[model samples]
Target: MEGWLGLLLLLVHNAAAAKMKIVEEPNSFGLNNPFLSHTNKLQPRTTPSPPSGPSHLFRLAGKCFSLVESTYKYEFCPFHNITQHEQTYRWNAYSGILGIWQEWEIENNTFTGMWMREGDACGAKNRQTKVLLVCGSSNKLEAVSEPSTCVYSMTFKTPLVCHPHSLLVYPTLNERLRRRWDEIEQSLSDELITEQGYRKLLREIFQEANYLKSTESKSEEKENQKGSKRFETLEQCSVANNELSEELKRLKSILDKNGISYKNASDKTVDHLVPSNPNAARAEERFHLRGDTGDRDDH
Candidate 1:
């Protein structure tokens, strides 16, 4: 029984050792190796190598007034004025101890050139610098500087830096008047009236004038009729007043002869003295009979 127990323990020890060995072995697929960190092995290369040469340079030909070369040949032309002139300059790669120039060539509007720099003038060692130049128009070199030892860079301003078309001259008074007259003439030409249109306009004006005159005459006739009506009303009121006065005088005479005293009543008492319905009807009938009698006498 002890031998069987020892055999079981030995088998367990052997299995654990085999597991550890499998874990310690280097991964052939390199999926998970502690020595090969995930960051270093899985990460992709993103940064590019440093350029072995210098960047391209561009300049206008005759406009570079400060350009002074002793050993190098330089030529320039205005890109805007000419299309056949060469506009690019190259540096000799083997000429100067610090920098060398290469061949300069131009194709259409683009200028290409190559250059090499062996070292800097400030006691710097060989840098193996290369340069490229591209030609362009309307670009002005604003400044050039060498911030590092033997390294140079330049700043350029485009032709559109300043607005040239914005500059304007004020016109004279006569010029402004002439322009205004020109505009008026153009408008008249554009709105030209034909003979038929002119005649139609004249007819419309005449019709409008006649309509206005007719309306004025009608208004005047209405005013005259109204005034005549007012005059007739006044005459009727005067005749009625005269008749009333005569009637009152006759009444006074009758009262004197009868020896009866007359007294005026207040408006409220007079209003209360309105006749009854039968009395009013009798009075209206008598008025109609009197009117008929007057008509018969006139006839």
Candidate 2:
């Protein structure tokens, strides 16, 4: 009986060990750090305490991508009124080959973020604060912005000046709260933080992510609007070139009557053989009509 009981204990130990997995991740600097995956997924079991999340001064901001070429653009709208060409920008934050509009957070050297759970309940919706980690910070953090993936993130070359003051995954803090939760998991007699802590952190982040910061972006919209305008100017330049070429031809006929050639940039003596009209201040031909490369799009 003693040997049989010992065998049962060994089986249980092996089963428990298989439940928790540490995944090794390769980062930007090519270092591998281990991340622990939660064995049991937690669900939000209660309403937000403050209902409306807390107000924060700073906001989390990063790029959006449908497909990242130059500027991360995800949508294309061919509205002739909004400007000329089709405008490409980030489209859906819920579903794309790449992920969606992720709500990412940052603080100190630690980082954490979440992704949408793949299933029917969350299968369609972009992972809101309820479940999504855009990116995080930690001394041993890895950054990967990859091909065919919409990774919203921020990287601090140095550690954050101040540590984040919040519960990790109250609602769900990624790395920002991972360290705290790691400690809490040990303290709650092997359970992670209480339900109260998770909700508290969730509420805090919901409010925090929604706030407008002093470092807000008003220019990004203006800039995109400006980018669409250049395509319009390219059309105008084409018209201007045609008008100049026509007038130059008329002037050349007048000069030919007096047997003169005005073809070179450095030669200006042909002025003496021009017509006497007051407008004989001769309309100029574009001697250097350059080819249109879409350099105007840079502005």
lDDT of each: 0.33, 0.32
| lDDT per residue (tens digit) for residues 1-299 in model 1 | 99999999999999998888444655423322335433232221122122221121223323431222342222222221100111223221112222332221222212232223333244545422222232335564433334566554333344432333211111211464445434333322332222333333333332232211233335765896786524357788787667556645553443343333445584222112122344344333322222111101112
Over 4 Å off in model 2, which ranges?
A: 1-97, 101-111, 114-144, 147-299
Give a tens-digit lDDT track for model 2, residues 130-241: 1222223422212324332222332222132233533232444347545544443343332122344443333344445441111223354467567653435777877766
Best by lDDT: 1
Error of 2 at 117 (Å): 7.8
TM-score of 2: 0.19
